[model samples]
Target: MRHTDVVIIGGGPAGLAAAVKLWEQGIRDILILEREHHLGGILRQCIHDGFGLTRFGETLSGPEYAQRFIDQVEKYKIPYITDVTVIGLDKEKKVTAAHKEGILEIQAKAVVLAMGCRERTRGAISIPGERPAGVYTAGVAQAYMNLQNIMVGKEVIILGSGDIGMIMARRMTLEGAHVKGVFEVQPYASGLPRNVEQCLNDYGIPLKLSHTVTDIKGRDRLESVVISQVDEKMQPVPGTEKEYPCDTLILSVGLIPENELSLMAGVKLDERTKGPEVNEKHETTVPGIFAAGNVLQVHDLVDFVSMEAEELADSVAEYIKKDEKAEAEHTQGEEAEEYMADVVTDGNVSHTVPQKISGKKDIRLCMRVRRPMKNCAIQLIQGGKVIQEKKMKKAIPAEMIQIPVKAGILKEKENLEVKVIW
Candidate 1:
């Protein structure tokens, strides 16, 4: 088996950033494996601007943002292989992948899972309709337009107010295609505030909140989609059905973290994030295995993904140094599984990542609310007592709440709860 100091799966923003950070930490012998022929991941398909606003302070396109790190990866001469599909990962940190050269197995001291996320397709959402060619995921249409130079269709009816859908509504309008309207089951826009304002409002694309595409009347290609208003239960109001004629129906329902490899490697998963359960260091329950980026939790922006990778790189360094010290001492035996207290949530809180708190260190809880709340307060409670409380102007499920709690605070009590005071 070929060996490496660290093996990073999926050479996207997460992998690239981690490699760069790890190299900066004086750690080399890193290998990044990517399934695609090129790096950059989904960023290559996103041609529109508005990226890098957080990190670079300059509004950049997705490709431009990704190139910033890709250039760094090349400048540092970090080794990475394209068109290599990682098939399996063992608990022992053995990675099995298939390449043109043949099956390759890598024994790694540390493995960073950066496979990112996948767009939820028609089947996943269970849209009632005939399987039609004109139907496409927002990401697919994005790729078709930006990378392949192909226009998907003339008229589009997008389902779901996901950021991609909102962006595509404006993108299609710019490309001379008519975006009839964007339908969302939720009352509020699911994407960012800026995306809703710029991509939809500015383009005069109608955002039909509290509405959904109940039925699609397409056979060979898309003919029309039946739209209807939904009640409080998010169920379609029967008599409110109206047909919108369109050749293309774009689905941008949601994103699911690509965590099969993590599960295969025996990493415990957070049900809410649908990703790996990580510690503050971003290390998983499996000692040498770590996760970052959308694979760990679906991040709203690429900048956050990069930040996670930077921190994760440091954690990997810490793991390596500790492992080396243990080996030298001949005390490198397997570590007994330690108890990790659950970070429970109540009220409008949907879920919290790094669900299990282990060791004593300052922790950042990345959480998402179940719904939007105005003039809300967040509380960190320990054993029915409020340890910390902070007020917020607003909190939305679409945005991740980065709550920092000081170290040694978790060990102070038996149960930790995050309650949203609305």
Candidate 2:
């Protein structure tokens, strides 16, 4: 059986960044597994610029942003295997993967999961629709248009206001396709406001909020769709049915973190994020195993994903070294689980990362609001006392909110609660 110090289970931005960080930290025995023929993950298909602004202080296309790290991985000669799909994982840190040649197994001292997330499809939302050729998820349509030379349709109507859906509205328009409009079920847009402005507004596309696609009409290919305004409960309201003729229906409803492998490894999942329940170090319930990027929670920006993965890699290096030292001495380390405390939410706050924390070091609490709010104040409460707070002019579900807290303030706190007050 093959062995390595660490095994990163994806070659996307997250996995690449983690591998580079681990190498920099002097942990050279690492392996990256990529399911695609090439690396760079989804960024290869994201041709539009506006990425890397946070990381590089300059605008770059998705592929360009990813290539920067891919170059580093190559420069350092970080080991990687392409066209490999990891099939199994366990608490023992044993990884089983399938490849063109045959099944492969590896035993690693530590594991990092960076498989990212998947788009919510038509079946996920159970959209009442016929099996038609013109219907495609926003990501699939993006791959078809950007990677493949095929254009999805000439007349398009997007069913969700997600970032990808909005971007595709512009993409299809630039490709000479007529985008009728974009309909969303929620009262507010699900995508970032900047995307809604640059992609939809700038392209002269209409975004109808509180609306949804009710039924799809077609035989072999898509012909038209039935749309209706949704009530407060998100149920389709009667007497608001409208029909629009379009050849394509694109969905960008939402994203789900890919965690099937994490589950197989006995990692506890957060019901809210549908990802692994991780501590401040990005360590899952199973020691020696960690998770980052979209596999931990869907991120709004790729730059943030890389940054989070780097942080996780730092923690993994520390874990590996600590374990080696313990092995050399034949002594078990001290248990610090008692210092861990749950990070809960109150008021309009939705969910948070580091679902729990040890308060032993400074940490960033990434979270989102349940709805839009103006003139809001985010407060971190510990043991009935306010420890840290940040005032924001506005908070929206589309944009994630991150607040930094110091360990000095959180030390000895039994629990922490985040509240967004408007």
Candidate 3:
């Protein structure tokens, strides 16, 4: 078995950033394993502009944004093998990967999980449709069109208003296809505001919220879709069904984090986030195993993914630097009577990350609301008392919410819950 200082799974933005940071931290024995032949991950298929505004201060396509990090790996001469799929991870931080070279076992001091996420396809979301040729997820269509230079269909009907669906609507429109409209089961648009405005509104594409496609017509190729409006319970309202003709149906329903390896490593997962539960340092329950980026939780922007990687790099470095101290803390963490402030959600709040927290350093808890609200305050409660609150002009589920708190305040409470109060 070969040994490395670190083994970062998945060579996407998160893994790339982690390698760069680890290199800067003087940790040279790092290896990144990517399943794909290329290292850019999903960014390579996304050819749209408007990325990197928050990070690079410039509008760039997905490939251009990823190229920046790829260039860094090449510049630093970091070691990474492509077309290597990591099969398993153990609690001891051992990694099993399979590549052209054959299966190999590597013992790593630390393992960073950046396997990213997978799209929810038609089967996962229960999209009732015939097995048709023109059906595709937004990402698959993107790869086919942008990467393979192929046309999916002449007419398209997009389901779900997520960023990808909206973007595909604009993309298909630009490619000389007629886009019928975008349908959403929820009352509010699931995509970002800018995406809705730029992709759909600017393109004169209709966005049908509180509506869902019930029946997908056609057997060989998509011919039409039966859509209907929904009530408060999200059930299709009777007699509200209407048929729309389309040659293609693209689904952008949702995404689930890739966690098979994490499960094998015996890492604890947060049910709400559908990802691994990480602490302030982004370390998972299993020591020396940390997760970041979309693997931990899906971020709305790729810039945040890079930011998460940078943060994870620092955490991994800390883990190696204070190896003994970290072990002691881990032991104490098991032996001691830890008073964890459980961040609960209520009112319009849907879910919160880092659900359980021990009063340590400052922590940032990310959350999403159940719906849209105006003039609300995020109330932090402990022992049935309001401890802290932050006001916001508006909060929407489409956008993620970041709440910061100091250890000093959290130490006073045994349990805490966050709620939206208007």
Q: Which candidate is the best by TM-score?
A: 2
lDDT, each prediction: 0.88, 0.93, 0.88
Candidate 2 lDDT (Cα, whole model)?
A: 0.93
Give every collision pair in model 1: none
TM-score of 2: 0.98
TM-score versus the correct structure, for each prediction: 0.96, 0.98, 0.94
Worst 10 residues of 3 by lDDT: 331-340
Candidate 3 or 1, higher lDDT: 1
Better of 1 and 2 by lDDT: 2
Tens-digit per-residue lDDT, 329-380, candidate 3: 7753224444555667786786777676777767777888888889999998
lDDT at 167 for candidate 2? 91
- Candidates in descending TM-score order: 2, 1, 3
lDDT of 1 by residue, 1-422 (tens): 99898999988889989999999998888999999999998888888887888888999988899999999999999999999999999999999999999999999999999999999988887778677779999999998998999999999999999999999999899999999999898999898988999999998999989988888887788899888999999988889999999999998899999989998999999878889988778989888999999999888988889988998999898777777788899995457666677788885788887777763777778888889999999999887788888899999878888978887666632557889987
lDDT score of residue 375 within candidate 1 = 97
